[model samples]
Target: MSPVCLIARDEWRALLRNRAGLLASGLLVLLVLVASFTSLERRAAIEADRERYQASVDEQFDQQPDRHPHRMVHYGQFVFRPIAPLAFFDTGVDSYTGNTIFLEGHRQNSANFAEARQSSLLMRFGQLTPAFVLQTLAPLLLIFLGFASISRERERGTLRLMAAQGVAARQVMLGKLLAHGVIALIIGLPAFLVLSGFAATGAAGWATVLPMIAGYAAWLLLWAVLSVVVSGLFHRSRDALAILIGVWMVGVILLPRVLPVMAEQRTQLDTNIETEIALHRKLADIGDSHDPEDPYFNDFREQVLDEYGVESIEDLPVQYAGLVSIEGERLTTGIYADSAARSSARENAQNALVHDFSIISPLIAIRQLSMTLAGSDLASHYDFLQQTEAFRYNFVQRLNRMQAELIPGIGGEDPRISAEYWQEIPRFHYQAPSPFSRPSDLIWPAAVLLGWLVALSALAAWASNRLERNLR
Candidate 1:
């Protein structure tokens, strides 16, 4: 047998004989199983709740009492962003972003019910998902299992004995790495299986599932290589374990939280209240539709008369007041959209700053990658907002157009368009972006994770060379 193969077998045997190692590995496998089950259940519950709410809201829109189109605009529609199918595996920034949005004419509302606002600070610790398990907990488990792989051998003078017996140091290091890499794979198995099961069952697509698997595999292997390198470099097993744990805490736990806070602090976005006030101010600056003598309306009235070749609004083919209302709504909606775009830009800037730290911490990269793939990231939220805005504009304008065309034909002191027009208005249906359609968002994070894997592999190779020199 090859020296590397013999060394690998002996190391595997030693790992099996270590009762504590077996127990730790067993516990991690169990934890992964538990996390998978809970995550799947949690996702199902959230999906059902959101679906139920959506149905209720749709019903409410359909059952509205007879009212003016403008009144209905004030009543507004409620849009609920659906939870992505694979969100169960990695909730990512879902908890931080608001899920419910109120859509009305002339104003843009912030998403109202963010999970962060509802939950306790304990949420900041992190949610229990496959991503969380693999990113945060799996590394610690790998370190515990393998931190003593070479350090313990050196401490007990077994490394020297192995070297004297014609086993090369490189072979010994490679053997330990192979054994523990298998252990890391085992630790990550249950989560991977759950993710695969989700894909198999059609809850997630292969596009998302494959990239997630690859990213997580890279993450775990990076930690495995890191563990072996640290163990080989350190003279004492205890020092190896302590150093590895410290690194895990800082990289996995501390940085994800701190970077977000810094990002928010650096890019201070306007509060929703401030945004709404600004929008209202902009709208008021434009002439009011209700005032017949308003300058903007006067000019608009002349324009309408010229188009129709009529001297007075009443002589025209359409209702003059309704045309003015439509024009007014157009102006207000335009301002609202501009304000919304500005706010979205600010939020993107904050997220971009956080993404910049992905290079320093792969956890941020993986978290961003997971969320983006799952369709629960900020970009998805923005898409929902933009779609809802479009729907609101369409619904409002259709009603206004009804008043313009229908009210004039039905002429009266207070012309009322048939309530049946409401039935003809189309309902809002949200269309989520497909996984493959959004590759740019996922690319940077994947690149960061792969970079970490390459860097750590190089470090491991360097550490092995040093171990070879010391043994000779």
Candidate 2:
């Protein structure tokens, strides 16, 4: 048999005989299976709840009695963002972002009822999902299984004996790497299968599912290589294990928490209260629709008369007050949207700063990537808000038009449009972007994982060369 093959076979036998290794590997397999089942079930529950809420909201919107258009505007509909199919694999920032938003005219509401706000602080410990298992815990398990691979051989003086028998250092290192890499693959396989099954059954797109699997695979292989390299460099098995564990703690636990705090501190986003106050101030400057003699309304009144060629608003073919209300709403809605965009941009900047730290910690990178792919990240939340805002604008304008065209002909002191106008208004339909459209967000994380793999591979090579010299 080839020298590398012989070494690999021997190493595999050694791993099997080590009770600790067998027990750790078995436990990891069990954890993966459990994580897959629980995450899938949790994801299904969330999706069902959102769907049911959306149906309830839609039904309520359809059942409103005849009232002033502005009354319906204040009574405003609620829209719930749906969970993405791959969210089962990684809950991501879903817990942080609000799932429900209230839509109304002349007001931009912040998404309310985020899970983070509702949950106890323990939620920050981390959510249990297949992505979480693979990104954070799986690496630690690989380190525990492989951190003693080469170090133990050296401590027992068997490495020197192998060199005396003419077995090359490269051969031993390669063999150890092969064995640990296979074990890492085994630990990650069930989650991959579950994700693939989701994709096959049309729960998620292949675009997201494939990249997610590849990203996770790269992440696990990165830890496997690092573990093997550390084990090769250390003279004692205990030293290797300690160093690897410290590395895992800092990379996986410490940075994900610390960076977000730093990002929030550095960016200093405006509170929702501040945002609402600023919006109110802006609307006040835009002139009230109810005030007949307001300058802005006076100018708008003239423009409508000029367009319709009438001497007085009451003589015009359409209801001048409703047209003014529509124009006023348009102005207020535009200002609100601009304010929302500014706030969203600020939040995104904060998130980007956190993502920059992902370069230092692959766990953050993978977490962001997984969230982005699952459509549960901040970006997805923002997308839902923007779409809902657009829907609110369209729905309100349709009602305003009904008031303008239909209320005048009905001719009452308080002319109300028929309830039939509400039925003509389109319901909100959220169009989530495909994973490919948002691939750039994942690129940095993917690059971080690739960088870790390359750096560790080089370190492994350097360690192998040193081992060869030490043996000589």
Candidate 3:
């Protein structure tokens, strides 16, 4: 073995000989394992309950007695977003964001029954999962173990002894980095195996899962290198420990919460009530189809008459009221869709502003990456909302089409469709699009993480050089 490798081995032996280091490492690994098993169990229970609820809703809708198509539209359907397999490892924003969306005609509902909303305030502190452990706690464990990688030796005159024994200063630094880096890998291995076990069960796609493993591995290494460099920067291990803890508090706890608030303040989106009120005003301006003398409806009625090759509404084959209902629905849907688009745009801008500061905190990058890879990000939830909206439009319009064709032309207010027709409308089946479909979503945050890795590597090299100068 090379001198650096020999030194690295000795450093590892020293850490192993330290009982406090061993206890801390053991406690962290135990915490990770328990968190993994508990989180997985929680996810499974949630998935089962959601599936049961969805099945019940589907059965109830299909079994409803023959009713007016418009009534059915107003009755609405409850659609559940499927839980992603990787979510067990990283709950992401899933708990905070609701999974059940109510799809009714004329209005869009927010996803409801969010766990965070229902749970005690402690939920906001973040859930117990592998991602949480590694992102928030593993770094602390590493800091505790490695803060003295160099400073302890420097304090005891061991550095001079090593130099007299012909060990280069940079070699000693590289040895410390390697020793801590290996410990980091050892710390992360259990979580990695947990993910692999998830992959083995075919619960998650290997495409995303493998990259998730890489991302987390990189995350841990980032902290490992960071801690080692901080050790080199400080002459005392206590000083190094204090600084690393401050960094942990700021990046892991403070900034994630603060940045989102700042981003929201900077790019505020309209609230649901405000959007609805605005929509009502816009719909009123479009002119009511029910008013006989309203120019908009008169023109629409004339156009319908022209299309049907008839001189009056009474002479038309289809119900005129049904046609008007269809037109009204189109108008409202258009406005609602525009408002939804605007709200989504503003929310996305806010998220972008927060993500732009990935340089300031790699935790932002890792949290985003884990959520994206796990398929529980805000984008995925929004995808579900968009799909539900489209399905709602199609199902409601189909009902309207039935009313137009089957109802009496003049008096179709109480027209009913066959109960079988409800079954034909199709239950909401989520496509669960591949995480890779939006590569760009994962790419930038990943690039930021990569940038952190590169910057840390540079910092390590600089620290090594500084160690050499101090030795001279």
lDDT by residue (1-472, candidate 1, tens digit) is: 8887777788789889989888877877787788778978887887789888988987787777656666676777787888888877777667877888887766667677878788888876777776777888788888887889899899999999988998887788788878877777777777788888888998788877888888788888878888888999999999999999998888888888898899889999988688767877888789787565688787788888999999887698877777887898888888877877887888889989988988988888887887888787878878887888888888877777777777766765655555565666787778998756777778889899889888977787888889989988
C-alpha-based local distance difference test score of model 3: 0.86
Q: Which lDDT tens digits does candidate 3 get at residues 1-472?
A: 9888988898889988999989989988998999999998998898899899999999999999988777888888999988988888998888988999888776767788888888888877788888989999898888888888888889999988888888887888888888888889999999999988888888877888899989998988888888888888889999999999999999888898899999989988777788878988998887875454567788889999999999999898987867887887788889888888998899899989898887798899998889999988888888888898899888778877777787673245466767988898888899877778888778987898899889988887888788888887
Clashing pairs in 3: none
lDDT of 2 by residue, 236-314 (tens): 9999999999999999989888987888898888887898788889899999875656787877888888999889977
Please tell me which model should have the higher lDDT, number 2 or number 3.
Answer: 3
* C-alpha RMSD of each candidate structure in angstroms: 2.0, 1.6, 1.8
Model 1 has how many clashing residue pairs? 0
CA shift of 353, model 1, Å: 2.1
Candidate 1 vs candidate 3: which has greater TM-score? 3
TM-score, one value per model: 0.94, 0.96, 0.96
User: TM-score of predicted model 2?
Assistant: 0.96
Residue 349, model 3, lDDT: 94
Clashing pairs in 1: none
- Give all candidates' CA lDDT scores: 0.81, 0.83, 0.86
| Evaluation by lDDT, superior candidate among 1 and 3 | 3
* Model 3 TM-score, 2 decimals: 0.96
